[model samples]
Each structure stands twice: as structure tokens, then as C-alpha cells.
Target: MAKITYVNADGDSTIIDVANGDSVMRGAVLNGVKGIVAQCGGGASCGTCHVYVDPENTKPLADMHRVEDELLYFTACERKENSRLSCQLPVSEELDGLVVHLPEKQL
Candidate 1:
């Protein structure tokens, strides 16, 4: 399991233990953590599960796929260097202590 931290735009932080092989979005939703909407479930087709990976994260994430990359352009929040789709981030021991910041809104 991996302990992931979800920080809301308002500064609230919630830490959840996500089982390995689950998506980051699923962890947040199941834990009832505010900020992540995940309108289309864990599908990268929707940008509702958007999040900003901690800029200081040292773990190596898999390179972004074309579908997620393209969908991010239409997110409700401004895309940044750390912007990512939580659904595309599968949980693993390597991602322990991962921190992701939620945007102000998801539409």
C-alpha cells in the first residue's frame, strides 16, 4: 500500500492509504476526500480527476501517455508543469508518500 496525500486548493490535506494497483483517483474518491470530482471515473478521457503532482517528488512516474496529455489541455484549471490526471497514476510502493494538489474546480 501507498500513503498518498491529497491537498485541496483551500489548503486542506487528506492522507489516504491506497492499495497497490489502484489508481490515485480511486483512492481519493473512496476515502471521501474533497477536491477530486472524477466525473468519468478513472478514465483519462475526462479531466475531472486532474491533479498537480508534487513538484518536489523524486519518484519517477511513467511518462505521460498521448490520451492523458491531450485531455489535460481542457481541464477546468490552468495546466502547469506538474499537472497530471490522477486516474493515470497507478498506485505502487514506489509512489508511497506521494502528494497531489487538487485544483479549485472540476467541470
Candidate 2:
């Protein structure tokens, strides 16, 4: 399992053990971590699962796809260079220390 930390806008954080091969959004939703709406349920259609990856350690994460890159533009919060759609980021051992911050809100 990979240790994935989810930090809300207020700075409150939750650490969840996400199984390898699972998307970050799935880990958050299954464990009841607040903040991610996942409106499209991993379909990458809704921007509700948008998150900012840990800038310090994003090298292990997957490259953004056409769909996710476009969806980030529609997120409730303004997009950042580290912005990513959680559903598109599949967890792996290399991402054990991944930290993702939840936007202020997911509409």
C-alpha cells in the first residue's frame, strides 16, 4: 500500500493507505476523506476530484492525459502547475509518500 496524504484547504490532512493500482480518488472516496466530490467517479469527466500534487515529489506520478489536462481547466479552484485530476493518478509503490492537497471546494 502507498501512503497518500490528502490536505484540505484549511490545512487539515488525512493519510490513507491506498492499494497499488488504485487511483488516488478511489482511496479518498473509499476511506471517507472529505473534500473530494468525485462527481464523475473516476471517469475524469468532472473536475470535482482535482488536486494539487506534492510539488516536491511529483516525478513518480503519471503524466497528464488529454482528458485530465482539459478537465483541470474547469476545476472549482484556479488551476496550478501541479494541478491534477486524482482519478487519473494511479497509485504505486514509488508514490508511497505522495501528498495531494484538496481544493477549497469541489462543485
Q: Residue by residue across 11-54, what tens digits does model 1's lDDT show?
A: 98999999999999999999998888898898787899999999
TM-score of 2: 0.96
Give me the candidate number with maximum lDDT: 1
TM-score of each: 0.97, 0.96
Tell how far residue 59 is off in model 2, in angstroms. Answer: 4.4
lDDT for residue 23 in candidate 1, whole number 0-100? 91
lDDT of 1: 0.93
Clashes of each: 0, 0
Query: For candidate 2, what is the total of clashing residue pairs?
Result: 0
> Which regions of candidate 2 fall more than 4 Å away from where they truly are?
none
